[model samples]
Target: MVREVLTVSERAPWWRAPAAVTAGALPCLAFPAPALWWFAYVALVPWILLLRSAPRGRRAALEGWLGGAGFVFAVHHWLLPSLHVFLFAVAALVGLLWIPWALLVRELLGGTPGPGRAAAALVLVPAGWLLSELARSWQGLGGPWGLLGASQWQVAPALRLASVGGVWLVGLLVVAVNCALVLLITAPAARSAALAGVTGCAVLTGAVWLWAPRPEPVGSLRVALVQPGLVPDSPDSPERRFDLGERLTGTLAGQRPDLVVWGESSVGADLAARPDLTRRLAELSARVGAPLLVNVDARGADRPGIRKSAVLVGPGGPTGERYDKMRLVPFGEYVPARALLGWATSVGKAAEENRVPGSAPVLMDLPGRPGVRLGPLVCFESAFPDMSRHLARGGAALLVDQSATSTFQDSWAPAQHASLSALRAAETGRPVVHATLTGISEVRGPSGGRIGPALSTAASTARVYEVPLARGTTLYVRFGDWPAGAALAALAVYCAAAGARAVRLRRPGPEPSAPPARTVRGSAGRRAR
Candidate 1:
């Protein structure tokens, strides 16, 4: 019977692996482009079921890795144009983070789990998932894009939860609910435990929503976003792009915007080298009756390498307030470990020269307002929750992300990029202004609600937004990454307990040595008789 069971379990079915891969891709639908936010709650069911049914630990690990690769590739499919086949390689490498998570799931839910194991599964599986997310969130692996919690950007209750524990907490709850649902579907005996887990998550979310401190309504700001849209590709495309942005800013002359914002790479030349361009921006700022926050993508005269900077141009040539971009897009900005990966440039749109990183986050005060401090993030930096949280902690009234996604304008990348602002705003309890060169320009209130309609990629125009400013410290900002810390602690305790149990089971027992001596004594007594 044991041999028969082992053979049956070890027999590999080819379709099982592919099923897991397809199951993993289902979660991407919850993100933008499809925008099926509610789907996130059950999206992991099929994947979890597949993992739980794996015949052996080794096969389970393989399924986990393949599923992770599928998920990463699906969510970031828009990067195909820029990264080409290299995207697959990247996804496969990052997918390895899920191996341990898969093993944990099989251990807890594979067999007919009793109520105790089922209850533990509800917590441990989610914590394991979070650990995978935490691992892949490192900048080199790929920043926190397509986080499971980010799918709920438009959900009000989810946003409230974000205020209490950041995206980590939201993700943990989401995965926990998925685990419960999986148990409810596959483990009939564990249905009571599953229901209890679901109830716990609901109660916890409700408590946070009712008790968490809300940002006080302080005031509002009138901000104008200048989107030049697409300029035809040409040798003089940079010059033409600048001209178009200038023309658009000129149209806002009588609008009386408190501040005018432009997207990343709006300025092509170094301000110090080209005084004429500086003067042109200054004149535009004067005409608009506000300081212009434009991005400069040029070789700096004072700096060593090509730098993308957020420069503040007042009525004067320059306000001397500038923020260099701190985070660079892995392949888009520079290939990682160029000595080993330099071949990436030849195959795709990877940057030939690496851009320099900024020394620190900068909070620039809007010229005329005493308390209106702006935290500027360039392009890829917006994807990181910590960057915005840190800036908000430093007293930034508003978080602004200047981005140019012209390369991915037609793809889901723009919409996915735009959606991150909502999460950031909700996490920090601050309004966010996402200004892009091509389109998808949007503003979110401090509560993560959209202030107005978003500009589509095809639109070439400027729009004004009434951005509501708030004043308060969010729990996430005050107590950073507590959810991740808690998850780590839970995993540690489980491992330690499991280790002790294994040690106890393997310990040696007392020897059975008395039988032999008795037999020999009996034989000697019989011979004497």
Candidate 2:
């Protein structure tokens, strides 16, 4: 019997680790505050280039993980105010999820130099990235906050693409463009394929704008977004918040808006339990001559626990229609496995009590406006496509999000949170009012264009927006995330094929025959040749 020995190489140097991290962080510039949305096109170029030097999949994945850590930390740095130094650790951990993405990228782009590989890299890399984004956006983890597609919130072409295929599609195109750029830089022979890829994307964008469903204004609403603002060190009193909201509402009385919208948790007590508060809101509604939609975050009046609800208050008082927030922000609203993470409140922004999630999206019928319905999403729920899509499908004439990024007022979070509404509006083909507690409030038309100047976080005031209502559903609302789904499926098939090929390459072939030895075969025989 013979034994075969295989020697494995040592790991790559430690310096490459930081290089990966730096590459990852570069993409953060593509987001808000210093939002260079165009930077996203080349942001990941360095990371892909770095992978070209990796000797194996493990090294590629390690570098990828480091880069992801950098990106995540930079993007979510605002969490430091609440999460403290622990935010870096969370970012690094989340970055580890990109290990597989690194391996996939290296396999498709690193080793070989061929047009076929370049083509595969273009499709698979983006698909893999979308998958990673999908994983992080799961309800248990952080919701989809820094999605690459989101960086294009202000881009008209991207908005049109989002309307056709949701943000996921936009992200796919972005990643595909990144991959094409990588191929363009690394493989000169594949330049034509890369150019073709770029041209195809341009064509797709044009097609979406030309052929995609365009939302037409069916009616309009005079809506007022009341931002009461917030002050740090303020007592944890919902009454104070409610009072502030009332004052803001009073200022809007002369405007006589069709609807009065307040930010999330503007009223802390459940209106059902507090008749006095309910009546006060109803009176405000009567005074304003419009239905007042107040967000109540408190212990459920009829149920056992807390609920974040949007209760409609007509001049007559609490209308039967109410919408509870379906999507709850992880750790913010409720921690996963409360028994273990319940202590988070002592250190960070985690809420003490978990707010119950609502069952279904409710399309609220406007009090006096017939044939018009308001789709309400609470806070982080606006980041989700399905919630708004369902409402749009149910015939919502407009969309409204009650959000408060007050705690992160100075951070990029407020800006990022506010930007999600534009995508949602475009995707659903309905005007969206992103009414918030502390500034960055914006109104986006059905086509995802800014309606008017955004309410800055620097002031507490009431601004009435002429929100143009669009009646109809976008293809994204009708077909859902079909592009992302197709990308996922295609990537799965590609990975399976690659995996089988790797197995074939690793399988051992027939061993060479041993030379004959006469002395071993016959003791007395001469040495055999």
Q: Pick the candidate with the highest TM-score.
A: 1
**Least lDDT summed over 10 consecutive residues: which range in candidate 2?**
1-10
Worst 10 residues of 1 by lDDT: 512-521
For every model shown, what is its TM-score relative to the native structure?
0.96, 0.92
Model 2: per-residue Cα lDDT over 1-529, one tens digit each: 1111111124466577788889989988988877899998888889988977787666787788889889889988888888766577678778987887888888788755588777777888898898889888877767788899998999999999999999999998888899899888778878888888888888999998899989988778999888988755456667887888898898877786999899998888888789999889989898889998889888977887898888889989989889988889877888878898677777787777787899988989998898889989999988888788888988988888999888888889888888899899889999999999887898999999999899988878888999898766789998998987888898889879879999999999999999886645575455553
lDDT of 1 by residue, 302-388 (tens): 778998999999998789889999889898987789999999998889999998888999999999989899999998899898999
Error of 1 at 434 (Å): 0.2
TM-score (C-alpha, index-matched) for candidate 1: 0.96
> lDDT value for candidate 2?
0.85
Task: State the C-alpha lDDT per candidate.
Answer: 0.91, 0.85
lDDT of 1 at 179: 89
